[model samples]
Target: MSFKNLPLLGTAEIIGALNLSPKQTASAANLAHRVAQSAWRRQPPHKRGLSYEEFASTVSDCAWLTMFEFGALLALGRHHEALLLADASRMVHHSARTDPPK
Candidate 1:
């Protein structure tokens, strides 16, 4: 299944999936930071009307979508697709911080 076709989960569902103990998920913090960074990178710079909380929320949603796509690709045994998603995610993150969207 393509990532786009994957169902969207609520915040509660996402949090539930990441319910592992801190020790069991040593990279959780890093993953979260990267996701936030990615979202900021993808946000458009001209869109200045959004408050900080709104901007963060939008970024968080994008990060979650990317993660969902990544997981879906993996589940479909599409390693190449997963890699592409990962690359896109990284690009979104780096670009947002470096270039400022729009």
Candidate 2:
């Protein structure tokens, strides 16, 4: 048996959730991942449970869901949005490091 038929490894797994071709998956995944930070999130921002679980599981991993969301925007050449997301992620990390825990 071969593992080739299995789900992707590393970052490739990100776009695999979207049924995309191998060549397009990497960039698509990167773009979606950065911009789709809220893809699986509940719109109202306070709800979480089994219902949310089902919604959350739709893409297996958050990165995949993010890819599904941002892939379309990437298709439209939204590189700036993707960059902004990356910067925001960095800012979040920096803040977390600087802030004291409550």
Candidate 3:
């Protein structure tokens, strides 16, 4: 199936978990979308699109979960820690994408 026109894949679920304001939900959804696109681009061209299993796995990946945790931090008024966590998560994902496979 085509993922080209899809909205953020897990927006509803993210919103449910975040239970935050619109701006916060939008921020969380944007991060989730980025993670999903990154994961999608790693797939082979022939199979490069959203699949149920991949969607499940991508949303559950540590990177995305870290973003979810970020939302929780915002809810708890821990902005500094949330920013650190997001930066760390992005670094890890970038490293994974750039590192040579063993």
What are the TM-scores, per candidate, against the unseen true structure?
0.43, 0.36, 0.46
Q: lDDT tens digits, residues 1-102, model 3? A: 222323344545555665667666655545555656666768787776777456646454455556555765666577998899888887887998999999
Which lDDT values do the candidates have, in the order given?
Answer: 0.53, 0.49, 0.61
Q: What lDDT is reached at residue 33 by model 1?
A: 43
Candidate 3's displacement at residue 98, Å, is 0.5
Whichever of 1 and 3 has more lDDT, that candidate is: 3
How well does model 2 score by local distance difference test? 0.49
Clash counts per candidate, in order, are 3, 0, 0
lDDT of 1 by residue, 3-95 (tens): 222224543353356453433232333344454556556768787667645665655566665665455445445679779979987897888
Write down the RMSD of all candidates, one decimal each.
9.8, 12.6, 7.5
| Residue 3, candidate 2: C-alpha displacement in angstroms | 12
| Model 2 quality (TM-score) | 0.36
- Candidate numbers, best TM-score first, in rank order: 3, 1, 2
TM-score: model 1 vs. ground truth: 0.43
* Rank list by lDDT: 3, 1, 2
Candidate that beats the other on lDDT, 2 or 3, i.e. the better one: 3
Q: What does candidate 2's lDDT look like per residue over 39-95, in tens digits? A: 545355564443533653454443454444355345546668756755665687689
